[model samples]
Target chain A: MAKGYLNFVLHAHLPYVRHPESELYMEERWLFEAITETYIPLIKYFQKLVDEQIPFRITMNISAPLITMLTDDILQERSLKYLVERLWLAHKEIRRTKGHNDLNNLAKFYYYRFVEQYKIFKREYNCNLITAFKKFQDMGYLEIIACPATHGFLPLINITPNVSRAQIANGIKVYEEAFGRKPNGMWLSECAYIPELEDALNEFGIKYIFLETHGITNANPTPIYGTLAPIISPKGIVAFGRDLESSEQVWSSITGYPGHPNYREFYKDIGYEADWEYIKPFVAKSGHRVDTGLKYHRITGKTDFKDYYHPDWAKEIAEEQADHFMHSRINQINNSASKMVIPPIITSQYDAELYGHWWFEGPYWIYMLFKKIHYNQDTFELITPSEYLSKYPNIQVSEPAISTWGAHGYSEVWINPGNDYMYRHLHAAAERMVYLARCITKPTEIERKALNQCARELLLAQSSDWPFIVTMNTMVEYAHKRLKDHIGRFNALADMIDKHDINEEYLEDISYKDKIFPNIDYSIYAK
Target chain B: MQLLKSEYYELPAKYNQTVIRLLVQSPTRMFVYWEVSDETIKEFNKNNQNYSDCTAVLRVTNLTKNYSYNIPVSPFANNYYIDVEDSGCNYQVELGRISKKKFVNIYTSNIATVPSDHPASYDLSKDGVLFGNYLCIGNKKRLKIYGNKEQYSRFQNQNHTAFENRRNGSSENNFLGSSDNFIGSSGNSMCF
Candidate 1:
């Protein structure tokens, strides 16, 4: 008998970065890179498990922003263009590295990877990855959850009245529009949580949510079984806490599988490493260098002089690590179950992009991990939260502490001195949005359009991505610009609404530009 | 109309409203950002005879415990990060001027609730064991407990080498900076 269960939750999210005004903004590549490296690779592996008839149940949260981008015709077309360009670069690398055996082989590997993923993107899935995820959910192998519209950090945004409610309502709306049914679970933005958030989750019929380890361990009345058992909040929503050991094993770059020497180093991309003029065409439209996703070297230790990547070695290590992971879980469950009355459940949640984007061999690690668990061990079964709840419906009632999966496990990462200036603007805009929604009981078509756009702008501004990027110090310029753009557009819309002079032209342009949540009702903020 | 230029997106300096907003950052810390409109500042100085002797201060009151402290701040800074001693306490801050140790109210903020830093010492745990065919949740509703017993038979263990020894290499070389902690290392996508 399986002693315990392992719930692997992968949260896939990217801030909506679509610019119809510019052909290829450097920032747009964030989505394109995620699609190419993370989403497609994950889809291919999921398809593999299905074809082989491996009985696996995995939980995935595809954020509303990612879904909107994936389904948009422009992004789909742009993704194809991005893929074809990488293919072109890979093709060129094949000829360029002809004399060298290791570089040549790695180049060919990337060429085939791009080729296969391209076909899967174009032919199999028809350019919409959401459909692929939906099909998996229908097959009962995956449980896809919803996220806040635009991936706003709920804890801080909740300060503005009804903002969190609107975020939740619109998040579910986007989920239903994409997945054909309401979501059973929600991956809280950044796994951030507060007790009051349960009211919103319960209202939205979200049966369960995932929180950080301390959020559970530090709950009121104190969780008896610690993070091993899912606790039901006072409001009846179940909460799953991340298992620290499992998280550290996979997420710690210093000790995790991604930091292994054999894997392809994420940093050493060919775009910057190659001769400038030769790789310029594959770079950004602004002629600035960007990651072309064609890396030729392995991590090869902490040194700058990297060894040529060996895929065979990385694959062998991934399988070995999978075996190690399975055994570790078996040992952990064996040790924990002996002490506890109920079987312990270890929940491991990670950002889905880490798999293939940041950690080059991550998706393969997951693939191998699942395969090993299926054929090799019986200590723990892979279970989703809903499935676990179905088996063990009655849960301990406790209120979770306020928490997030950020540095120091709090709001410091999102609301520090670096990005604190934006909150006043966000709060003011949200208050105005609520006011507008309440006062404008009846409105013309353009007025309604402007109001709905107002809500969208506020939601986009509340995204945790902007402040996070500002604090992280990578791509600070783009983050500043996005926050400024959203807040600015929102104020302009509010001004036009107040003056009773709805500038149809301005509204039309922004409506098309920040066109997310097409069916958003401005009335969500009215309450 | 052409698209709004990037410069148009610059956020305004302040809304013309006398308001104080307090946000809970963590158990031990709270953030206070307020905008006192020019008129409100003028009105305060005009009304007060000892305006020159007044000091701008953030008077943070812990509503749950009934205690308060004054944090001296620069009025021109417009915002301050206030550290609190208590977790799981309701706190409110008033941004005002203090003259001769007397606080003159300007704008009181909405109550900010700092979540509990530690679990409640009061144990409310009940037996987690499945006692019957159905389990009741706090007299709310009864749910049938299926008790997942479907288990795979024990299989032969495969002999696989542990990969930890292979991780002897230092992570000094990289584009994305390396971190010793898991949350610190999560990539640009904000995994944590």
Candidate 2:
């Protein structure tokens, strides 16, 4: 009867860059910008849906490190200050550029919106972003999934079984602390699916997880339907494969709705256009240039003069795009559902930052998409991963092929020659830390401090950021420094322990400096 | 009981160099501090006895030339305080409490050599600035120096040029006297 069930999953994450000592650091803006543009906006959309009785269903993966940062007092205060500054700047821009009707109007709109959002963020939630998302999860309007601690690229790091287990176990602990409940589903970083990865997920009681399209189609049992529905892993965990056709429409640069001529062009930003003197204060002194989040032109045309964007017009376009995407998904599910006896489930997963950071009208489009699906009962029904898995309990068990949701659908993006060098040291550190953890019996306070410092070092080194940074060649120094510093610290601690020496004060200082997991046990590395 | 023994060596008055040998008898990494000039120190090597050789030497003599290297210390390092006094042509140093198992080096050329008249009980503020009851070198030069309560208050207000001239022509000893005069309302001491 219905076109089939459509499950939308958004994975939200950013590397932790809280420098409490530094008043103004460039990398810290990553969280601030995401909070202002993506997280808060998505929360508002979901809250509105609940208030309007929209009955919309969405699954979101909020990584453990992100959750920690969201709940951190220093980060929360800085984010609020950042939002207030941006709002003030927007107001000033509106007044300064009063002659440009569209720009001025849009500026005013954003200024007021930021002010209202800041008030709601600070006053209502007491400046806590996690609580806002938890409210939606608790209300049953959204299903919040957890990711591995620090969003570690598990398949690559799973070189050892213990590393994988630690990632999963630590993730569950942090997720429970932030969300007040255990997660039912997990989002593997980059949708990197390995056969044994699911065992760890199942061990932690995760009922389902998402994967790339090929992970289902190329299943060992050979999925007959080919990513048209969810597949159950041998561990009894459900694997929802991303729908390729639907993904192409949203992710492809040439054909994606985000590339529509009316939408804002992401490349044209005030960072380059505005006077250097005026923008210098905002730009970091580190000699690296990053997006300043203020753009003045729309995509306009393939090769034409710039046309200013109007937020009102952009909202209208977003609605149209939402309608278009919904119809496309319906057609996709209808064609597949015709072949299967049961209603096929279409899983659409995307990076959450893409909504607001890349597509200015992304959150609006998502809101409208859910609205269209809710109204058109015959075409599609919005469902969470847990909801879908429970309804369709029977599924084919198989091991997914080695695949990732990256450019080539392979490991080249993360593990090529350019980045493989770091992997050797990373693996060595991981193995050595585990060895040390296991050999030590009844870890004293000093041993615990050293072990935790070693864990922090290994985890920071294990960050997908280092490899991605090397591949992109942006911030390669920073990524390299981070990896080396952590590895060096880990090695230093290991060397000390090997010689039967424990310097508690030095260990404690490093433990505090690189503190990420407070309750982390050194024994996790050992096992 | 496993005891970790560390050795601290005091520099000769005429050597203008200090070397501290830290021995970790229990076979562990040890963080040691030197109560000398704020010059940078480098670990030369570790012997079979697990003793590490750290060497510290003066790099610069004048206060004005040394002010530029006083950037805010990275939060990762352990910090220690030292007193600098102008001995007319050179500087005399008094070491403060050596931080335990913490490694932080102060570049003598970057900090104003401790003034000869620096007071007792240098109060290390919460912000990591050493504020003495009298004139004291801050994390930075002249502008950050706290001679008295009033000057410290003014420094907190970010009056950058407040103590600039005193940093240049006046030696560390004259700098202390200048602060005293300014604090005692002796004359309209130029802010810079």
Candidate 3:
């Protein structure tokens, strides 16, 4: 009469934006903020769990590109410098608010937290964050999964099957290289899936992958047990569908538990409130306010008078939210299990960065939820996808329906009218590269180099970020440039080969420039 | 291998009376052939450098083959492989050993190396190349391509400026800003 297991997966990803040419690009703040708010705090929580001898199991998907940025010495050094500056700014704010007891107390708390976290980041973790997650993974408290090389969208780019295959293969290679072992499951970029994609996943030796809610519910055979159970695809890979009810409670900005009146308001940062002249040191050159990680007020409420944020109160709210969420999940598992002939799994997936970063109390909530689940052993337990798959190997097989956790159930958000032009170019580039690869026989050294360069360009251009950027308009220009630069290089190389005036020096120069997929074969295009 | 004239290479309706000439070259001699096909030879044209038309041009240098036929090109039969016997520096020409249908197609063109005698070119200053420089194949004799010294120093300066801008919460016209407009768009537009 063991209770059903709850498999929780958190996906962590950010686009690569290490601006060696600019010391203060606003986009770079994404990584720093994630590091400060999400990564460092999660590590501390995991370490505490280990210290207390708690047997908590969690699954995480860390994208390869983020790992590359984390492991980079230059980025690490820059991040450390950035954190130190934040610490100093926090210290100043603590001193400035000395007369106001509540404000002063909150400022002091954040200042000390920054100082303590930075110490852990520098000394305990050596500013290399992956090792912390790896340590928990090694200790059996967590299972770490790999994601796409650059979080590239697989379904749309499956035009040349090899492009998608290479992304999967290369992703696994780099993931294993970083995490010290091969991953059991992979988080498909945006939970995007197509029937043909399963064949590629199976070919790459991936045993399990996750999908959105409808990907399973609306599946071809229409999963009889619903999202509460895992389905084995025709290709023998396990597919875990996300639970919508559980995800909504955490992902929704207005209704989510993080929006509790007691939690800190994510928007009311010190960067915008502090005096302009005094905060000039922290503002970017464009004068647009940016997140400085030092905030003063708790959410209070939608209409209530503002109250100074107290960490202790925030912790209480977190515990309450965790208890509520745990009870909801336990009820969900029980309700689902009773209806099924076998023990069901309730898979709750979320972005790892959501914890501690967007939702300040997220990691704590996770910690408390695990404790509550363990305490109530009769109703629920935490489990990883691998653990569940190993135990329930005889699950039903089905083909997941086409869907993504985007605007529509389809790829409209990532590939609609706003971004169609980018796709047109991408498709053209892919077709052309494939055509070029087929035409060459005994490629000269120059031809081989140019062809490889062309493949790299095509792959980079196909990255889902360019389209997302176009839709979001966050860094539309940068995304546009990336796509153009890569495609232009691809076309130019084609022109060089067509004219029989192959420029090896030029090819080598461009190859060194867009150095993604270093081992990618230009011959992939030839065929 | 047998060299049969493909029936899809028929002449267009507008050029029904046109007579196409064949030019086949080998080290020792050249052979010319003439023919007509009932079907049209409408080659499936892809802008890829590795397309059959481009590959045919490159392969012709060794053992060339040409057919003067009135048949329109079939979109599917766009590529053909030639077989040749190497006789010292010379080669014995053979035609149509491989067809597009039988061969796996490769669409990207091969990369050629920059010859030493070519114009002075910009060498990559960093171990990895940025996306901007991907379009720049060396040997631009007219434009002053930044050398390793200039490129590396400029990169360092830009990196410092970017870092400073981030530290101060500012967005300067550093490399990231300069390249912003071209980031998410498509088509043949260039970023500064």
Candidate 4:
């Protein structure tokens, strides 16, 4: 019998960054990059695992906004075009670096990667990632979970209880419409949880939720298993806490596997290293420097000086790291197995983007890990949250405490003094949004359209990424503009409704710009 | 609960809205913004034909704790934004007219929670940051990673600056323009 279970969860989320007016918006590149790097690599690995008949279970949160972007026609077309351009660039790189031994090989590697992912995007899923994930769900290898609409930090958005309620409701609605079934679990925005959020989760029929470890261990009645077992809320919502030990083992930069000198360096890219004139057309439209993801160097001892990347060396390290990770988990499960009434479950999760985006070898590491575990592991079984719950129905009842997975383990990173200034605007807009949603009982077609547009603006405005960017001090200007623009749109739409002169031109302009939640009903917020 | 309408006010069709809102700025500050449309303002002026003392009364209620406070708004201020000092309470704002010391309630905003800086907003948490350390909060307790000694020492050498930054409390501690703690050189595991 397996001594313990290992549950791997990947949260795939990106703030809705669709700009219909301008093609090639800098922010929109986030989606395309994640698709080419993270999403495609992950899917390919999972597909190989399935082909090999390696029984595995993983819970993935395809966040509402990311799903919206993935399914977006314009974005799909843009992603394909983006991939072709990169492939074209890679072909050029191959010819330009023909004489140089290291650069030529690296160029070929990138070319094949881009080609494979683009083929997967077009040939396999028909340019719809939702279909691919749903197929996996239907096949019982993966559980596709919904992330809250717009990835709002629920603890703060719950201030207007109805806003959180609407978010939860809308998220599931989108997931169900896309996947043809309700989600089994949800990845909370920032893993920030307040006690009242469980009621919303339970009300929406979300069976379980994953939180930062403290979210479970800090439960009212302390859980016996700590982060090893799931805690049940009074309302029957199951809460899975992250295994801190396991998480740190993989995520700690100093000791993490990705930091191995052989791995590809995330910061060093051709976009910055290459001749600006040569890389201009391939970089962002502004002709400014941006990561083209064509990294030619390894981490190489953490210096400004870099060494030419060795693919064979990186592949060797990836396999070793994967083996090392599996052994670490086995050791952990064995260590905890003796004390638990039921077999322990070690749950580990990370940002899906971290795999192929920041840590380029991450997907390769994951593939090797799964492959190593499939034939060799006998001590642990990979299981999904739903699978674990099914096997162990009875759980310790406790209400989780308020917590987030931020640096200080609270809302300070997001709600600190620097970003606190916008809470008032967000909250006020949310309140007025609920009022607008509730008040419009009888409406003309235009009135309904305007109301729906207002709700869209509210949802877009509530995204936690804006505040996060401000606090993180990256793209602060863009973040501020996004927050202000969304709220500004919401308030302006409200004014139009008040004046009883719905500006068709203005409404159409905004409607075209913020094209998310196509079938949203304003009544979702009417409590 | 009926609103008093004046003859001069041309209220929009189905014009029943009192743009009153409450936003939690921090653990201690609640920001309020409310606006009365032109039609409503015109109606209010027309109703006060004699122009007796007409003041806007802002009444705030903390529904979570069942506490309430009534603050007077400046009559001339059509657009008002005020900051109330409080936290950890679910609040609602009501705008009313005060004439001859009799209040007539006009608009009530939706309830919004004044977010607490005290992250211990849980029944299970006895005090401090968490619910009793069952799920365990805080990144302070990092388990010693069992890895190759060679890799560990190499990593330690590279991260010496991070440790130095932490000791000095310079860029890492500063929230302003400090991407050091957020992006590069920091290993804060994103808990999203």
Q: Which candidate ranks first by DockQ, i.e. highest?
A: 1
Instruction: Estimate the lDDT of model 2.
Output: 0.65
DockQ ranking, high to low: 1, 4, 3, 2
Question: Weakest 10 consecutive residues, lDDT, candidate 3 chain A?
Answer: A390-399
Q: In terms of TM-score, how similar is model 1 to the real structure?
A: 0.90
- Tell me which of candidates 1 and 2 scores higher on DockQ: 1
Interface RMSD of each: 15.1, 35.1, 28.0, 18.2
Candidate 3 residue-wise lDDT, B40-157, digit = tens: 1222233233333332221223322222211223334422222233211222222221244332222212111111111112222222122212112112201111112333245446
lDDT of 1 by residue, A1-527 (tens): 77899999999999999998886589889999999999999999999998988988899999888999999988999999999999998999899989988888988999999999999999998999999999999999999999988889888878877898889889999999999998989999998998768667767878789999998998764676789988765456678999998888889968987888998888888788789989998989988888999888899998989998899999999999888888888988988887654578999999999999998888888999999899988889999987887776545545677889999888999999999888888889999999999999998888999999999999999999999999999999989999999999999999999999988878888888898999999998888
DockQ of each: 0.18, 0.01, 0.01, 0.03
- How would you encode candidate 2's per-residue C-alpha lDDT over B27-102 as one tens digit per residue? 1111122223223222212211111222222222233333312222222322222222222112222221113333
Residue pairs clashing in model 1 are A405-B192
- Clash count in backbone of candidate 4: 7
Ranked candidates (lDDT, high to low):
1, 4, 2, 3
Q: Give TM-scores of chain A for all candidates.
A: 0.99, 0.95, 0.92, 0.98
Q: Which digits, one per residue and each the tens of the lDDT, describe model 3 over residues A1-527?
A: 55688888999988766655456567777888899999998888888877877788999998877887788776798889779989989889888988999888888888899988898899998999988888889988899998777787876666553667766776787788778998889999888876667656766667778988877876544455679888765445678999988899999877988889888778888788778999888766567777788877789888656777888899999998888888898788877776554578888999889899988888888888887777755687788988876665444435566657665555655755456555445655676777778888678877877777777667667777888888887788777766776777777788898888987766766654454555656664443
**Model 2, chain B: what is the TM-score?**
0.16
* Between candidates 1 and 4, the TM-score winner: 1
Q: What's each prediction's TM-score?
A: 0.90, 0.71, 0.70, 0.77
Q: How many backbone clashes does candidate 3 have?
A: 86
Q: How displaced is residue A219 in candidate 3, in Å?
A: 1.0
Worst lDDT run of 10 residues, candidate 1 chain A, spans A390-399
> Candidate 2 — which pairs collide?
B31-B101, B38-B106, B66-B109, B84-B114, B84-B115, B85-B114, B85-B115, B85-B116, B135-B147, B165-B192
